[model samples]
Target: MSQLMSIDTFLDSEEVLVDVRTPSEFLKAHIPKALNIPLLTDQERAEVGTLYRHKGKEKAVLKGLDLVGPKMSDIVRSFLEVAPKRTVRLYCWRGGQRSQSVAWLLEQAGFKAKILKDGYKSFRRWVLNHFEREYQFRVLGGYTGVGKSDLLQILENKGAQVLDLEKEAHHRGSAFGGIGLPKQPSTQHYENKLAMRLRAFDMRLPIWLEDESRLVGKCAVPEFLFQQISRAQLFVVCRTIEERIVRLCQLYGVEQKQSLIDACMRIKKRLGLEHTKKAISLIEAGLLDEATLIILKYYDKKYQYSIDKRVVSLYLNGSEMSDVQLAERLLNR
Candidate 1:
């Protein structure tokens, strides 16, 4: 018979792991590196759940078995193809029924299938706990056009440990975030990339991270990292709107002018069609200052909202210091 182990134990072992949760559940979140092989088709899983609630567990279980029985051979074959040659760990939502059933079937087929005791819920708890541990962080906070990315490049040159969350998420973290960026990773891939980055950092030193939201582009930030950002200390950079507008224009350049115009136009309903139209005219007329002023009110308010809601510690921008000096104070503070 195959053994059942806690999620921690399974993770500790040098073996492949499979997550048997439905694709939707797996997409929202899952153990890093676990392959998904759902026991039920999405529709069938919904139907069984509906039956279980309206009818009875006995009826649902019977129907579930009937649905899965005919596909058992194919499921086993697919599992064999993905499962490690030596040993494999399997888990479902709670480790009681679905995972155990799958493990027993795999064991009967002469494979070492270890079920994750307490399953994915337990693993999620572990991820949450890890984030609660006290770790130093070097925050990168700036206004919409302060050239934080460029500063990050300088910081990297100076050998500071940094995690470019925007780069990793393939998002710029704004209404125009998707412009000039690759397609965003799925939420699962985002979490996996985050975990990989965190693992590479030295826990003793501060890890540099940009100010970001719970969602970057199409992907939601992992629950753990979201919590960290909420509690982590912050450093703010300031620059004149003119400096920012020039930098934005240079960074985005002519290639993205039409896309920028479209992004501004889409905001018409929110900013009022009159105001949005004026902003568009400013862009078209090369009156970037006018366009920037209008956008600043909208974007600045949004930034303030996040800071207030997330309970971030604010460091006001210094007027006297140079950008490099401002960055140093923020990082060292």
Candidate 2:
């Protein structure tokens, strides 16, 4: 027999999750870690939907059965290959016939199945609602190359709750952020990942996050969470120009020179014609430190303006302390 479970109970269970939506639907967004065992190909789903619209539910049902009939054995086999135990959790777009049909088939094969109530739609609602609740956030603010991310890792190593937004977004929160990083997830997928991480930390404890603009690369922080980040107290870190230049060099030096030049050109208007040319020339010449220094002048001014708008809780001289020392100080305060 198959069971229908609420989103919370479904998520909390140890059973492996299987998504039975079309491949296109699964690609758009899904619960993290759920295996995609698409019930229909994209074309097939479109055909069924078109039939449902033009002919009616009865014809569509027959068409769907005709499409799924030969694939039933493959579907069960696919699940068997991935299933660690005899129990599994399944979901579709809206707790519709697809998931129900899959669950019934798996049950007949001697497997226990649980379905997500309201399917992936319910999980999305849960994710969006999660951002509305309050969380204790400690926003780390600094100009470019102040080692903010490095310090956050240190803080986490020492047992402080940290939410690495840039890591989640696969971006460094700069024009050059995507130079050598993996392709970023869609904004919907990004939110799903962020919400999952946010859920792991205790609401009562401070969750440290790097100060970010509304958009991190291509991903927008969910509005409610972004508002919370905007209002939270900021702990700013500062470093001298020379120290910052060295840090930036260390971070981007290994990336291809052309990639660095392309990144600089992306902000040409803001960086100004002469500055952009000079930075590109410096990068091609392999003077990464000098190139970074030129870039920082523009970034510093922009960051200072943003900092002025925030209510800073404190400022620490990053140049004077080790990352570990800074982490310790933030935790102690």
Model 1 poorest ten-residue lDDT run: 310-319
TM-score between model 2 and native: 0.98
Candidate 1 local lDDT, 67-105, one digit each (tens): 989988887888879864836888898887788888877
Which candidate ranks first by lDDT, i.e. highest? 2
Measured over all alpha carbons after superposition, the RMSD of each candidate to the real structure, in angstroms, is 5.2, 1.0
Candidate 1: stretches off by over 4 Å? 50-59, 84-86, 150-170, 180-202, 213-233, 238-243, 250-262, 265-275, 282-294, 297-333
Q: After the best TM-score superposition of candidate 1, give how far the Cα of residue 236 lies from its true spot, in angstroms.
A: 3.7
Best candidate, TM-score: 2
Q: For candidate 1, what is the lDDT?
A: 0.76
